[model samples]
Target: MQITKCLHTALLVADLARAEHFYGTVLDLPKAERPLNFLGAWYQVEDYQIHLIVAESVPADLVNSEKLGRNRHLAFSVTDLAAAKDQLLVHGCSIQMSASGRPALFTQDPDGNVIELGETQLA
Candidate 1:
């Protein structure tokens, strides 16, 4: 069967409240829904959602969770990269530029999850 869409993406965090503040308040992602049984919160972006899950411990197979790098990243296209970077900085998030230059900036969430914010450069 073919996959039509990505239902959600999950990130494990040590603290749910901090993750909620970062993803919900700092990143400005709208809350879709949260279940009491599930130890996570769903944050909606354009057509998809990022799920931040609180876990007591991280699995050994989680490579990205061990180290924050470029390989594992979530890229978001924005109208203004500079403005987005400024806002993220105000939230105390660290920013980095992509190899392509100033069109994009990379940063991490409260749990050190890499997120890329860039301007949609259409050819």
Candidate 2:
């Protein structure tokens, strides 16, 4: 069997409410069906879906600070990198550029999960 595509990506979040605000309200992902006992929410973006799972509690080390450059990150391809950066900034996200001269914006959800917004050149 051949691989088709990614169905969803699950992120462990400290606060389910915050994740819902960011991914649902900010990113504007449509609502997806979620299990009542799941303790988190799911958002749909085009074909793929993002599932935010609520963790036990917020880590003491990560409290009061935004997660930056952690080992894990999710990248979303956009049509306009600059526009995406501006939109993210408008939503109170901290945008950072990559060192490779390519346009990129970095932001974290309330749970300190890093979300990357970038674009690929069309052929």
How do the residues 76-97 of candidate 1 rate in per-residue lDDT, one tens digit apiece? 7888787888888898888777
- After TM-score superposition, the amount by which residue 69's alpha carbon in candidate 1 deviates from its true location, in angstroms, is 5.7
lDDT of 2 by residue, 1-123 (tens): 999899999888887777788888777678898876868888888889888878897553433234344336788877788787777778888766764566766777776677777787898
TM-score of each: 0.82, 0.79
Best by TM-score: 1
**Candidate 2, position 116, lDDT:** 79
Model 1 residue 107 CA deviation in Å:
0.5
> Which ten-residue region of model 2 has the weakest summed lDDT?
62-71
Candidate 1 error regions (>4 Å): 58-69, 121-123
